[model samples]
Target: KFPGVPRVERVSFNKGPLELVRHTHMASLGDAAHFEVDYVDMPAGFNDPDLSLEGGISGLTHALEAQGARVLTKEKVVRGSCEGRDTTLFLPHPPRKEGFVEGRAFGSGQRYYFLMFVGEEDGPQLREMARTFMESFAVTDGCTAQPAPTPAPSSPTVVSVVEGTHDAATGWRKIENTELGFGVLMPGAARHESEQAQVEPFPITHHTYINEDDAGVYAAEVFGEYPPNFHNTPGSYETMLDVTLYAMKRNFEPSGFTITPLRDLKAGTFPGREFTVTNEKLGAQGRTQIYVTAKYIYVFTAFTRGQAAASAANALERFFSSVRITTK
Candidate 1:
């Protein structure tokens, strides 16, 4: 007999025809946990006597009392009859499935069905589906204790993260070995604290050092304590690319630009490109070795002595062709 819902129509009270009547039978009680179901099957049709309805209700009340839930609290609910057949429909929102899944009792029979509203805020996506099931519910009439419906099995996929670390001794060592060392190859140094100022206001939890002097370093930080719910942020690879490209082109250059075609390599082989351009002003003719590998864009510069600029360009081509990118 919750104030919100006007009635409780047990389908068992209906005769041959499907009729739903909303009664004003209402009440407010203590915790709904203190309730029970009792069975009372009346003869078919609206011709059943008023006592049949009262008997059905009395039987349920008796069953409830027998179950020891009848704590005589001051709780009160409205009660009455429609085309009476034994039933205690209009009452406190009945104890529901979640509360009764283990099994329940009312008297010689058990009653199923409790009221609940899973609001949209609880989980917005499945609201319509849940409402569809709620609207289709039919009240039971002739009392017969029945087993509760089987619950829908949940299917959830779980991923586990295994924590560990890798040693750094395998890579080519470059720079001062003060833990500030840069491994030209891929092995990462042991984890240590970074001394540079974080580029952004967010606290930095992870970072990498290519040049310690540049303290203008690669910093990975986040505002919150948890990983972001969405991956809209860029990582080290993209950030480094942007910073490097910006530094190279901040000032105008004379030779313009030229990009060679990419050559695909077979397994165990390295894929890369080669290109050449000259700066007329610096007279600084240089040969550039271009090796595009998994971890980096290695562009090594070798200056041409005297007027060997054109020859150095050809040498640059061979250098790129000979260089290897290996994962072994």
Candidate 2:
């Protein structure tokens, strides 16, 4: 007689969590009770749980009854006994499937059976391995069952990162995730790698990046400066204005150029660099300008066309209108 674990009790480990154990007469074995579910409740807006369980178990009992099998339920535990010629094996309920079944294999003369019940705690983690092991017990007479099914592994999900700007008119948006920072986002309609590649007759050489849209055009220059010590001279007000205007003329010269100074005083002061609206051929016809106040120069030039120039100027008016300097 293959009597099961004699005594069942919960135990704790010094290194980790607690576990349950089952002791037997000959050699006691550990309890595989970690996945046992003590209780469960069906939430609203779900199918009827009771009816489903009844249907599945009823079908299983019917199948076994047809094969002249007797059903027995032990009220309380009994001492070991092996009197019956046909053996019956008691198994834990299948964790996942909502149905159960029993089958008789006449050729092999073996009876296959299984039980289905609502899952307990840790149901999900135990279901995959448990289901495969139970399914392999297919009505084998003297033959050994096939191996259990193995589950495929899974991987983690990934996320992307971006940066942006915020103001009263337009909200926040991320330009891009980059190593260079905000200046890299300056628009470019056409861009040249180094000052040497720029249009000829322009004495100052620079590495430039440019951007353009109806709002405005932006041209940035990284160049050598007057002091000969490039870094020291950069970030100064006047020097920055010169480099910015130079880059603007270079960009718009293919057409023509003119500048109109506004008598209306805007709230801010133009630093060493200045921004102005110039007659330039492109979207809208007014120019949006920028100045760099440093040993080296960086410029952003934007222009608008015809009536559109006014709108472009307004959009970028902040460039010159908002320019200011601090003593600190």
Candidate 3:
């Protein structure tokens, strides 16, 4: 299925009455993408052949909804059944929602759930991947885990060439730009990039600052300014927050890290969300935070390699909390 930079992983687990088996596949940098298909078996005693799966949240549907809330946006769902098994599919926006389609099967003794996630990039192939998965979803009377597939031949990896241009002196320092009307704390010199977003009819400038930690890992603080009073529009602030967070994820993804949003990030006027970042190849893990202002949006995130979450956690919290926006 993975024609480009083919790499895939599979794992299975059984926890008393709960069983989960997942298959993860990865592609190369340019066409970088992640696709995972999950099979879940739970001990839920639901006995009703004519039950309405979409009537209300209960049993398998209830559990499916809970998981959907985490991975998918709070959008309306497509309801029906797959192979006579009641199903609820969550079609979240790509790149942001990371391509999650959730469903479940109702049966006595042991119920089943099917979930497929595709992220990083989207195209016709990914849609086909989803279609094929759902078309094959069903309840297996005697399902068993398959042996791990043999590893494919190694291939060359692609890395980012964007290097830090900030020549400021070393040591943790406060980065400020009065012209831009914002300041932030950065571990070291940060690379800067500016470009016009690919938009039809109209386009806006986008700016990003990326800095590196002592461990050779990198962190980014991205900000983009829009037209006058653009943030005044209804839901403008929320839109900026969501778009900024998604941009930050795309920024880190090229380096082989996976990101997942955990919340909507709202408290009064606070305009940002929290995210978890992981890199299985490097064993690095940490969180992401980004705050949006009236006319400016920013994202600052970092992760530590082979260490506890403490190092990256402190930096991330400090970096995000220390932001001061004059325009806000």
Residue 90, model 2, lDDT: 31
| Candidate 2 local lDDT, 1-328, one digit each (tens) | 1124333333322211112132212211133321111111222211322222232233334444454444443121111220111112133335633222222111111111222321222344444434433233323234232222222223322222223343334332213212221142332223434433222112234555444555555544455332332222112343334334544565555566654432322113334333455653443444443433233344444555454535555645544343232211
lDDT on C-alpha atoms for all candidate structures: 0.29, 0.33, 0.49
Candidate 2: RMSD to truth: 32.3
Q: Summarize candidate 1's per-residue lDDT along 30-62 as a digit string, tens digits.
A: 333222222233222222232223333333344
The C-alpha TM-scores of every prediction are 0.22, 0.30, 0.43
Across residues 1-328, which tens digit of lDDT does each residue of candidate 3 receive? 3435445566675422334454544443353334333333332222222232222123334344444533332222333332223333353454564444434333223333334343333456765665665455444453322223233234322223343234254346666667666666666666666654422212334566666654534444444454455443334555555545545565778988898887655433656677888888988876776666655565656667766567656666666666665654
Q: What are the per-model C-alpha RMSD values against the true structure?
A: 29.5, 32.3, 19.5
Choose the strongest candidate by lDDT: 3
Best by TM-score: 3
Task: Arrange candidates, best TM-score first.
Answer: 3, 2, 1
* Alpha-carbon runs more than 4 Å astray in model 1: 1-243, 251-274, 287-294
1 versus 3: better TM-score goes to: 3
